[model samples]
Structure formats: C-alpha cells, structure tokens
Target: MIGVSVIGAGFWARQMHLPALAQLPGVRITSVVATSPESAQRAAAPYDEAQALTDIAEAAADPDTHVLDIVAPPDVHLPAVEIAAAHGKHAICIKPLARDLDEADRMLEAVDEAGTRLFYAENVPFIPALQEARQLVDAGDIGTVFRVKACEGIGEPHSPWFFDPDRSGGGAILDMAVHSLEFCRFFAKAPITAVYAEAGTFVHHDRTTAEDTAVLTLRFANGVIGQCEDSWSLQGAMDSRFEVFGTEGRILVDNLHRQPLQVVNARAGWSYPMPIAGLVADGHLAMLGHFLDCLRSGAPSLSDGHVGRDVLAVVDAAYRSVASGRREEIKETTR
Candidate 1:
C-alpha cells in the first residue's frame, strides 16, 4: 500500500483529493497538515487512522508516509517540496506550480537532487473530453493545428486567498488561465514564444487589488496561436469551454451551460453542476490514481516539473505583458 500525507487541508484537499484518495485502491491517507491543529483535526476526522498536525514537518517525517501531496498556496509550494525532499518522499503538487519560474526551478532542483519523483497535479489534459480531443488531433482529424480558444468564467472563488495577489501570485489570470494555458501547450506540442495580455478588475474592483478578469493571447514557436479568457465576475454556475480549430476540422468541448443533463429547481432556476470538467470532475480521480500508479511503478509523470515550470513561464510573461502594455517574450525552460 502507498501511504500518503497531505500538506494542506483546504477546499481542494478536503473536498477533492481526500475523496478521490479514499476511492483509490492500495492507498491510504496517513497524515494531514493544516494551518492550525483544530483545522487539521477537522480535516482528518473522516479518516480515523489519520493523524492531524499543524506543521508540514510532522507529516514529512512520518516513517509510514511514502508520498506528500501539496495543495497549499502558491508561495509555500517550494518549501513543501523541500520538506518532502529532506525525508526522501515523492511529491505531488497542485498547480500553479510555484509563484514564479525561479522558485519552480529551485523546487525542481530539490526533487532531482533527492532522487524523488515529482508530479504536477494538472487535471485539464486528463479530462475525458479533452483526452478525446487530443486523440482526434493525434489521429489527424484536425489536420494541421493552427489556433485554439479556451475560456473559463466563474463567480468569486470560495477562498479569500484567491483574491490576494501576493498569496495567489495573481487573480483570474494566474489561477484560472493556468489550466487552459497548459492544455494549450499540450495540444500545440510547442514552446510558447511570446504572450500578449490585457487584464483589469472591472467587476470586483473593491474586493481585490488583482485583476478579476483577463485575456491572454499566446504565440507558440510552431506558429500555433492560443487565446485564453478568464474571469471572476460571472454570475451563477461555472462556465468553461474549449475549441480547437485546425486546417481540416474543428473540435469543441463545451461544459459551461451546455451539459448533457440539466436540472432546474423551483428555487434555484437553472442549475448545471452535474457534469462539470472543473470541480468534482471524474478527472480528479484519474489524476490521483495515475500519481499512485507512477509511484508504485517508478514511472515519470505526464505533468512533470519541467512542464509545470514552462506553464509558469507563460504566466510570468503574461503578467509582464500586463505591466508593459506590450507583448513579452517568454524565456523557455526545459527539463
């Protein structure tokens, strides 16, 4: 059995990761670390065998733990990885990998030096609909890929930290666009050359200093262009969609308001929360299972440190472009 310790017990950790881990075979939750002892206890309450601690070091030092799953904020990512490295444990970190490219590199160096595997828990590409889209592109149904469009619009985030630029690194552009951007690179199979972006806090100006909505256009080295739109102002349910246009045909995955099944309640009007690709998606289960499988078989992750770092580079360039009011060249980083 692969015993794992979770570093953070926040929303994603409490709702998604733990539930997914519970359903997986031959894996157990050994420890849970939270900001406070009470919160940790609350997080670990579902698992009677699990221990709750306030410090990551306590979980990292656990002899029964084989892997560390980090779902903390952007800033603490590298430090969590360092603690795992010190104890010779494999790590799975949720994106955005780090606050910036430099910290990402340092985290990569730490994992490599410790001879431990690192997985970036990005679920966009693993989505069944997106995976089908990828297969179509691979089978040449799309002919020569040229342009892609991905968008995500949602109401305010559940956590307050998402609004703080310092804690989240940025606002919608950083938290929401990262998924679409990574999947764009995955399909393009090319490095991003430059990024041009425009962002503003038009909707929630008083709530956050960071931009609540933004759009980014990416130019890939292979001549592929990608457009991404992210927002925190949309009302009601979440809306996310992707479209890939190629020389021959086009592929579209719409999960926003157009789901297979829609339920409308007398009190709640129109609700489409059943088949979302984002929250509570089946992709989360697949992602966690893949991580455990890789841990057991000693295989490399599809979303490794290098891929995570490259995604951050695009984010870095996007923010720079937002400041300079001009397209910024991305300094590509490779594994």
Candidate 2:
C-alpha cells in the first residue's frame, strides 16, 4: 500500500480530498499537516491511523509517507512540492500549479531533478459531463471541433486575500477561468496559440486590485476558436457550463453540479438528461489512486508537471492580454 500524507486541512481538503481518500484502495493516510496542530488533529480524527502534526517538515521527512497530497493555498504550493521532491516522494498538487509560470517551472524542475513524479489535481475535465463531452469528441460524434465556449460563475463573495493580485494571482482569470481553459484544451486536443481578454472589477470596486469578472477568447494552433467567461459575482448561484460545436454535430454540458450532459443536433434536435459516467470514480479519491498507480508502476502521470506548467502559461498569457488590450501569444513548453 502507498502511504499518503495530506498537507492542509481546509474546506476543499476536508470536503473533497479527505473523504475520497478514505474510500480509495491501496492507499493509507499516514499523516496530515496543517497550520495548527489542533486543526490537523481535527482533520485527522476520521482516519484514526493517521498522525496529525503542525510541522510540515516532520511529515515530509517521515519514511513511511510515500506520497504527499498538497491541497494548500496557491502561494504555499511550491514550498510543499519542493519539500516532497527533496524527500524523493511523489506529489499531487491542486491547480493552478503556482501563482505564475516561473514558479511552476521551478517546481517542475525540482521534481524532475529529484526523479520524482508530480501530478496536477485538476478535477474539471474529470467531472462527468466534461468527460462525456470528451468521449463524444473522440468518437467523432461532434465531427471536427471548430469552436468552444465555457463559463464558471460563483455567486459567493470572495475573501480579501482573493482581491490581492499577488496573493490570488490576478483575480477571476486564474482563480476560475483556468478550469474552462483547461477543459477547452483537453477537448480540442490542440495547443492554445494566443489569447485576447477583458477584465473588470464591476462588482467589488472597493478592492484595490482585483477583477470580479473576466472574458477571454483563445485561438488554438489547429484553427479552433474558444471563448471563456469567469466571474466571482454573478446574479444567481454557481453555474458551470460548456458547449462545443463541430462540423457534424455539437455537445453541451450544463449544470455540472447536478446534471451531466445535454446534447442537441441537426438530426435529433435536442436530447435532455443524457447519461454519462463521472470520471475518476470518486473525484479526489480517483486522483489519489492514480498517483499511487504511477508510483508503483512507474507510469507517466496524466496531469504531469509539464501539463501543469502549460496551464499556468495559458493563465499568464490571459492576464497579459487583459492588461495590454491585445492578443497575447502563449509560449509553448515541453510537456
């Protein structure tokens, strides 16, 4: 069994990663690290066998821990990943890999130098509806995909830290838009060439540096066009939707939290309540299992450090496009 240690016991970690890890096979939660010892203890209570410690170094140094699952805040991702790499442990870190592409590159370099594998835990493409859409595209049901549109809207107001450009990495674009961008990249199976974006702080104007909403247009290398919208302040509740148009047909995925796929075509018109299997089994659990499989078999990671860096480059280009009021070219890197 692969021994696992979770870094950070925050809301996402508790609600998603911890519960999922509890059900995964061939994996054991050996320890947990948090900012506070009490919080770590509380987080580890469900897994009685796991130790709770405030010191990250202790968890990183443990000989029993074969993998480190980092679900910490964006800023702390690099440090934790570096530590895990230094100890020759495989790591799975939540996206966006780092605040910027430079940091992501450094993290990737460290992991490569240490001869350890790294996985970027992006759950969007792994979601049921999105996965179904990808399958359809691969099956030629959508024919030649030419255009795509996606949006992620969250109603809740973000904390002050989210408003700080440095801490949050330029507001909605990196915070929310990356999900849709990555989805488009995965489905289209093409590298993004350039981006043109517009951003504004329409809702939360009081914040010194933060955009409450953003819209981006992407040009893929294979002649595909894509658009993405992201917002922290929306009229209604959270909404995640995506649509892909191709020569033969089209696919649409809406209400990702509840429904999976909704499809419409020239022949069949529209189909409601399309059935699709959720990717990754139990979400975070599936990610953990995949990481363990990679560790044991020396298999290549699905979302490796190279892929993580590419996503960050897209994010960085989007922000640059927003600032310059012109299209920015995305730099390609080895994956």
The best candidate by lDDT is 1
lDDT per model vs. reference: 0.86, 0.80
RMSD to the true structure for each prediction, in A, is: 2.4, 6.2
lDDT per residue (tens digit) for residues 1-335 in model 1: 88889888999898788878878999889988999888889888998588998888889898999999998898889999999998999889998998888889999999989999889988888787788899999999989999988888877777888888888888888788988898788788888999999999987888889988899999999999999998887655566888899999999888554466665555664556565544445378888898898888878778877888888999999999999999999985755
Candidates' TM-scores?
Answer: 0.93, 0.90
* Per-residue accuracy of model 2 over 8-60 as CA lDDT, tens digit each: 88777787787777777777888988989898999999996999988767898
Could you tell me the TM-score of candidate 1? 0.93
Give the clashing pairs for model 1.
Answer: none
For model 2, the superposed segments whose C-alpha errors exceed 4 Å read 157-160, 257-282
